[model samples]
Target: MKRLAISLSALALCAAASAQVTITEPWVRGTVPQQKASGLFMRIDAEQHVRLLGGSSPVAGVVEVHEMAMQGEVMKMRALSHGLEIAKGHSLVLKPGGYHVMLMELKQQLKAGDRVSVTLTFEDVASKQRFTREVQAPVTALGGAQPAPAAHHRH
Candidate 1:
């Protein structure tokens, strides 16, 4: 009985530690015919610090976490060599023209109202433990305006 109690306690602790990453408002930008790339935007909240490793999807052959920033008066977009970090108690907002998931080499044009399945990978900052979450993101119209950031909640 004592051993069973200990095991249950450990299991609960593991769940609390690793299952705190919440993904909300995930969406994929719709693509026009012949368009080869699109973006995935979402809000990520992590109770524990974690790194947003890149993700994969059946719709795209290549998926990368990219950032857009002004370089010498020109806007440049590039994949982050390392993943983006979400500090504990902070929310990471991914939107158009900022930090977002780049889905390239699209297999087919994504239409608005369609759904895409993407698997996002993440790593715990303290334990270096790797985990993945499956997200079903709805496709929005191409060139859709970026939405304002949602309020973040801290525990």
Candidate 2:
């Protein structure tokens, strides 16, 4: 009985430590069944200021952090080589028509209402700390009812 209690306590501690980064309201906008690309939106809350280095998902071969900006009246999207900065006690939001995670070379077709898992990596700028958080998000079709907007940040 004592051994069992100790094991359970250790498991709980590990779970908590693994989830240093909190992900909320994760959802993927709906796209054509065969669409080659799709975007993921979510909010990240960290206890301390950190940088989001990158992400990965089993559904896609490559996942990149991208930003959309208007340059010369032309909307351009570009990959951010430097990880995104997340200020302490603040939140970073990824949403449509703005900053988002681009999933490229999708390995599987994402259907509306389907749930997919994404892993996000974070690094603390001050301590050079690193951690990862996983979130399961449902895919909603484009033009579907939109979810409440998350906090936004620009590069």
Candidate 1 stretches with Cα past 4 Å from truth are 1-18, 146-155
Candidate 2 ranges with C-alpha deviation above 4 Å: 1-20, 145-155
Give one digit per residue, the lDDT tens place, for model 1 in 3-111.
Answer: 9999998777667655869988888888999999999888899889999889899999988899999999999999997999999999998988899999999999998
Highest-scoring model, TM-score: 1
In candidate 1, position 24 carries an lDDT of 86
Q: Which 10-residue window in model 2 sums to the lowest lDDT?
A: 146-155
Question: Candidate 2, after superposition: displacement of residue 67 in Å?
Answer: 0.5
TM-score of each: 0.83, 0.79
Error of 1 at 77 (Å): 0.3
